[model samples]
Target: MPDHAILTADAHRDLRVNTERSAASGDAVMSAMVVPDELRQVQNEYPILFRRNLEHDRFTALAMFGFEDGENLFLEGTRWAARYLPLSIAIQPFLIGRPEGADTGVRQVHIDLASPRLGSEGLRIFEEDGSPSPYFHAVVEKLGMLDAGYQASIGFLAALRRHDLLEPLSLEVPLADGSTHRLVGFHVIDEERLRALDPAAVAELHQAGHLMPIFMALASLANIGALVARKNQRLRHG
Candidate 1:
C-alpha cells in the first residue's frame, strides 16, 4: 500500500502464535488490539474490503499477510503463514504424493500467480531429526491460495476501515498433534460490501504478459462452491 493511503496501529489480540518460533521468541512477541469503538465512526471514511473463502462459506478473512495472532509479518521478517479455501485444488501439482525437500518457487515470480508455471519439480526435505518443532508443513494436497489472497484483501479493507485492524476471533482448527488452540483469530471480512481497489494495480501486475497463464488458470479454478479433485478433480471456489 502507498504511504499516503495507509494508517499504522499496534495490535496483539488475534495474531496466531508461531509455535515454531514462539518457543524461542515467545517472550519477544508483542501484541496490540484494533480499537472497535474507533472504527465505527471511521468505517465509511475508507473503502471497506470484504473477504470470503473461495472454498469455505462460513467466515471471511481480510487480505493482509501476517499471523492471525499477531500484528505484522514484518515483525518476524519471514515468509507468511496463512490459510485459504481454494488452495486445496490450486497447489495439487507440487504437494500431492511428493517426497520431502520440494520447492516449486511458484511465488517467486510476480506473474506466477496467474500462470501455470509453478514450483520447481521434486520433493521437499523433511526436517525431522527426532525434535518436535512448531513449524508444521501447511499443505493442501489441495489448496488455500486463492482464499489466502482473498483473506489478504480483507485485511487491507480492515486496515483501511479502522485504525485498529487486527483483532482476535474464533478458528475451529484441527491440529496435527491432537491438541487444539481455542479462540484462534480469523480477522473480519465484510462478505457483502468491499471497496473496489484500483484496477491499475492488477493491470500493472499482468503488463509483463508472461504471468497471464496462471491467473487464467486461477480464473477457471476460483468459483463459488466449486469442488475439484486430483485426476478426477474439478473446480470449486468461485
Candidate 2:
C-alpha cells in the first residue's frame, strides 16, 4: 500500500527522493503498462501489445517485460537494461490527483510518503524559500506530457477498435531447458487486417497522425524474440 499525501512546499519542503535503482530499494520485476507517446522508443526495446482489463472489459496498450509474471528480463542486477523506460515506470511514487471541489481541470501532484525511494539525499522538491525546485518542475513537466500522451491514446485505441485491427495473441516459446512457455490473454495489431484496410480509412488514419504509431506497434513484435533470448540467458546463467 502507498502512503499518499498531497505534496505541498510548506509541509514537505525538505523531502528528498532516492534516485537509486535496486531491488532492495523496491525496484523489481514490473509488468507491462500503457505508454502512448513512447511508441517509437518503446518499440526499440519492448514488445508493445494489447491487454484486456478483465473487470472493465476494455483493452489497454502494454509493453511486455518478461514472458511471465514476476519475471523482468530487463532487470540486470537491479539496473533496467532498456534505454527507454516506460512513463508508468518512471513516474513511480507520484501520481496526479484531482483537487477536492475544484473545477479548473487542474490536477495536483501527490507523492507516496512511504516509498522506498524517499530518502535524505536526492532531488529536493522545494528550495529553502518554499519555491519549487528545478527537479520538481521537471517532474511536473513530465507528468503533463504523460497526461497528454495518454489522452491522445484514447482516440488511438478507439480508432484501432473501430477498424477491428486488434487480434488475440497466443505465444509458445521453447526454453533452453527443453521446457515450453505458453502465453495467453494478450492481443496484437492484426497486420493482415491493417494492410487490408480500405484506402479511405488508411487515409483517415494518416490524416489523424495515427498511421505511424500503428506501424511502430507492429514493428515492436520483433522484440519478443529478444525478450526470449534475454530470458534464456538468465535461465542458463542463474
Candidate 3:
C-alpha cells in the first residue's frame, strides 16, 4: 500500500531518499512507461514499444529492459548498465498530485512515505534552513519534464493513429541454451505505412512535431538485438 503525503519543507525537512540503483530500490522491472520527448535518448539504449491501456482507451510508449516481469537485464547487482536512465525510472517515490476540489490546475509534489527509498541515510529533501536541496530540485525537474512529455504524447499517438502507422509487434528470442521466449501484446511504428505516406501527410506530422519521435521509435527496434544478447549472457553465466 502507498502512503502518499503532500511534500512540504516543514514536514519533510529531514527526509532522505536512497539513490541506489538496485532491485531493492524498485529498479527491477521489465519495462517502464516512456514519453515521446525522451524517445531520442531512449532509442539509444532500449527497444521502444507501445502498449494499450484498455481502461483508458490509450496507448503508452514503453522502454523494454527484459523479456519477463521483474527481470531487468540492464541491472547488474547495484548498478544499472545503461548510459541513460529513463525519466520515468529516475523519478521514484515522488509523483505529481492535485488538490481535491481545486480547479486551478495547480500541481503538488507527493511523496510515498512507504517507499524503501525513504530512509535516514540518503539524499536530503531539504536543508537545515528548510529550503529545497539540490537533489530535490533535480527530482522536481524530472517530474516537470515527465508531466509535459506525457501531455505531448497524446498528440503524438493521435498523429500515428490518424495515419495508420502503428502495427502489432511479436518478438521471439532464442537464447544460446536453446530456450525461447516470446513477447507479444505490443505495437510498433509501421515502417511500410510510414514510407508509403504521401508528402502532404508527412508534412502534417512534421508540422505537428511528431515526425522526429516517430522516426526515433522506429530506430529503437535495433536495440532489441542487444537486449537479446544481454539475456543470453545472463543465461550463460548462470
lDDT of 2 at 177: 89
- Which numbered prediction scores highest in lDDT against the true structure? 3
Query: By descending lDDT, how would the candidates be arranged?
Result: 3, 2, 1
Candidate 2 residue pairs that clash: none
- Between prediction 1 and prediction 3, the one with superior TM-score is 3
Ten consecutive residues with minimal summed lDDT in candidate 3? 97-106
For residue 145, give model 1's deviation from the true position in Å: 28
Error of 3 at 191 (Å): 0.4
Off by over 4 Å in 2: none
Query: Candidate 1 vs candidate 2: which has greater lDDT?
Result: 2
lDDT of 3 by residue, 1-238 (tens): 8999999998999889999899998888999999999999999999999988889978899999999999999999889999999998898899989899887468999999998889899999999999999999999999999999988999999888889998999889999899899999899999999999999999999999999999999999999999999999999996
Q: Candidate 3, which segments miss by more than 4 Å at Cα?
A: none
- Cα lDDT over the full model 1: 0.27
Model 2, 99-155: lDDT tens per residue? 888885778899999888887788888899999988888788878877888888888
- lDDT by candidate, in order shown: 0.27, 0.84, 0.93
